[model samples]
Target: MLAKIEELLEQAKLAIDSATSVEVLYEAKVKFLGKQGSFSHLLKEMGKLTPDDRKTIGKRANEVRDILEGKYAVRENLLKDQELNSQLEAQKIDVTLPGVAPERGVLHPLWRVTKEMCEIFSRLGFSVRTGPHIEKDFYNFDALNIPPDHASRDLQDTFYINDGVDRKPGDFSPWLLRTHTSPVQIRSMLTEKPPLRIVSPGGVYRSDSDMSHAPHFHQVEGLLIDQDVSMADLKGTLGFFAREFFGSEVEVRLRPSYFPFVEPGAELDASCPFCKSKGCGMCKGSGWIELGGCGMVHPLVFKQVEMEYPKWNGFAFGMGVDRMAVVKYGVSHIGLLTENDLRFLGQFRP
Candidate 1:
């Protein structure tokens, strides 16, 4: 039995030394030390021996087990260290390699143009103002001198909230998405006194969409009120804006037009920057490009806001911000500004 135990220990030692991995070493340990193993089988046979012989064999067996356990532990740790080193060598990163760069984002062209226009106006002594996209009928129309029967009040032109279906016969004015930023001017006039110069830039909604128009668009409207404000001041300011925004060489002109909120309104035009006022396809063979509308404030508008008419005269001008972006960036369609295509928008990176 002693010779057999010694032979088994030698076999275990050889198995432990030959094992290439921890899994193989664990299998070797189970083979010798398990319940059905050689060591357990030898102990079972000792039941037939005398008590003194059984005690001596048990002592020898325990010493052998301890020695084998120590050997297995040392071999296991060495194998683990070698495996870790191999993995480290295989997975090491190259310090000389260039790091991957993350993609960057840019401002949308619409917002970029909006900020540029606002900054340009800010330099001209106009502070910025904004109003709610959802507005009351009074501020949008009535206070702006736009009569109830005006063409813009029709369902086809304006987007009325709740479709005006929940209104009673004599309730408050109907709510609607604002048609223009002019409502901001009205609200400003109600709370502020004359000598107010402001530019309102924000989104407006209409019940229309086409190549040139959209259901939702943006506008920048300017209002300047003081004693003795006139059409000449409006033209001069607009001309300076054209020169500064388009180019130092660009010129501005005003043609007779009509708007409800102004006593004398004119369509604002700029000499085609693309052709330097020479005929071109951009200006449709004409030397001018229609920019927007400008006018002297109507007396009826002042009456609605309770401001003395002639004592506090002013001029208001409004232009489509989308149109400005289109002209500035040479975009083919107004609808392109709203379409969230990355391919189209990626071109405007700063």
Candidate 2:
């Protein structure tokens, strides 16, 4: 029985050493140490022997079993280490290879135009200002002289959040995503005294989306408040913008237009760069391209903010940054600016 136990131990040790993988080593271990295995069979046979012989056989069998278990554990761990090392060698990273070039990203068209517009205003002594996208109806509409059921309020086509504040259905309060940056004009007027000249640039939302319109777009609204601001000043300011933006040679004109927020408002136009007033596909046979809207601040707007001092007056102008960028960059569709197509966007190097 002692010789048999010794033989089994030698066979198991040989198999453990010769085994190419941990799986094979585990199977070999089970053959010797399992419940219906060699060691267990040896112990069962021990009961047939004399009590003294049984003690000798049982002790030898247990010793061999314990030794085999300990060796199997060591072999399994060593096999694991061997596999890890082999994987490490196979999947080695070559540090000597040339580094991949980091991809460069260009500014989005709207942002580019916004930056350019800000720079243009900055040159004219106007500081850049920003305000929240979410705003009260008073600042967005009422303070801008837009009445409750007026065309401008409906014209905004706004997006309002449901805060569950007590109000009738369809009777939304001041809370809404700002449809325009004109609200910043009220914010500025309320907070700061006159001689305020600022260009507010930010995201504005409307419940509108199409080929040329996005639900969320950008606008740079310029305000110049001081004594004796007029329509001519507004025209002059916008003309400067057009000239600086397009070229010193570009001509600008203002056609009479209306906004409920701005009394006697007009849409500014600039000659098409491509056709140069000779009529082209860009201009649709008209020499001019509609750029933006500008007008003197309405008296009701100042009254809404409770600015009683009549000496302060101003001209406010708003131009869609995306629209200007489209015209400037010769982008045919507004969707291209928002669409993150690598092939389409990669063309705008600057």
Question: Best-fitting candidate, measured by lDDT?
Answer: 1
lDDT (Cα, 0-100) at 317 in candidate 1: 97
Off by over 4 Å in 1: 1-10, 42-67, 83-97, 100-103, 163-173, 278-281
Candidate 2 colliding pairs = 137-174
How do the residues 1-350 of candidate 1 rate in per-residue lDDT, one tens digit apiece? 88888998899889989999999999998999878877888888988989898788789999999989999999999999999999999999999999998877889988898888888888889999999999999999999888788889988889877754666753334799999999999999999987999999999999987767789988999999999988999999999888888999999999999999997999999999999878887788899988899999999999999998789999999999988888788888778888899899989887
Q: Per-residue lDDT for 217-304 in model 2, tens only?
A: 9899999888887877887888898999999889889888888867788888999987888998778889888888988888888888
Candidate 1 residue-wise lDDT at 331: 84
List clashing residue pairs in candidate 1: none
Candidate 2 residue-wise lDDT at 278: 91
Task: Give candidate 2 misplaced runs (Cα > 4 Å).
Answer: 1-99, 152-156
